[model samples]
Target: MRYLAGNPFSAVTLPATLAPEWSLQIERALAPELLRALRESLDAHCARPGDEAAQCRIARAAIGLMVDSGLRRAEAAGARRSGVKRVDGIRGQSMWTLTLVGKRSKVRTVPASPATLDALRAH
Candidate 1:
């Protein structure tokens, strides 16, 4: 049953075809909890007053953008280089967006959060 279920090309219906559910359960069970704590620590570091604080602020903002938008590493790097630009949104109100070239030379625009915009401005 497991073999047949794993094989997408199999024509037979298996009595036990729980691969998708099992995969999701396994992923949830193995997921890390420390990442959240680490993110909190980074945010705190960015708030501190010191010479490195400026760098920390940028790091926090970049990481926040990545997490919020699910941006690829290359996309994030390109965003940093090109920076965020303000443009007219759907209703003509100004909004922040990041424009960069992704894989295959595709031009992609990523919406920027207020924090990201402030961080880019700081940089």
Candidate 2:
């Protein structure tokens, strides 16, 4: 008779069912210490003298874009010089932003820090 039921477990609550529901633990961003370590490592690499130093500078710039602007990997990878725009801000100050296509092909502009912009310029 029990086998007649579509699901035998449906009629009873098993001990395993009493366990607490599991929730996903997601890390949204890097910790400050980790971020600092990463920056130091990149800077160290950039300081090295060699042909690879040029590539390191570019890598640092790309990583700077990702860290400063909250850009996704693909967005930073596809970033172009033409996409960087300078606009006038309050009190005649200059503001910089990077325009890029994000997820789902959505076009958006994100603010760029001076340090990051300088890195890009150097690269």
Candidate 3:
């Protein structure tokens, strides 16, 4: 059984009835190596010289955040659809960040990695 609270963002409590094998399958599917390989292949495909190089750079960064950071599909979509923002930190340091309305309409922040920052700069 699963029980939900009045607040959507509140966690749902569910009986621990999932089969161990099924959980293992999910773990394998989300393995870091597989995600890393996917990110590298997409980056390579986008890095090839082309008229769409500019667009490719942005796509590559998004893919990195999605695969490396484990962003939810909705979070990724919202970031691209609504756009990201740059903020200046202490002493004029700048960083790229995106606020995404994720599960249950909860707002969360995802930081850009150095590689992602470089890709954003290139684009």
Per-model RMSD to reference: 12.4, 11.6, 11.1
Which sections of candidate 1 miss by over 4 Å?
1-39, 80-83
Give me the displacement of residue 17 in model 3, in angstroms: 33
Candidate 3: clashing pairs of residues = none
Select the stronger candidate by TM-score from 2 and 3.
2
Tens digit of per-residue lDDT, candidate 2, span 5-71: 5965777964532222223223566788988898888888889999888988888898888877788
- Tens-digit per-residue lDDT, 1-123, candidate 3: 345535765587865442211111133246678767866776776778886766777777667666544566677766663446777888999887666666655566666667776665676
Q: Can you tell me which runs of candidate 2 are displaced by over 4 Å?
A: 1-27
Question: What is the lDDT for 100 in model 2?
Answer: 76
> lDDT score, residue 86, model 1?
81
Backbone collision count in every prediction? Answer: 0, 0, 0
Residue 57, candidate 2: Cα error in Å is 0.7
TM-score of each: 0.57, 0.72, 0.51
Which runs of model 3 end up more than 4 angstroms from their true locations? 1-29, 51-55, 80-97
Between 2 and 3, whose lDDT is larger?
Answer: 2
Which candidate has the highest TM-score of all?
A: 2
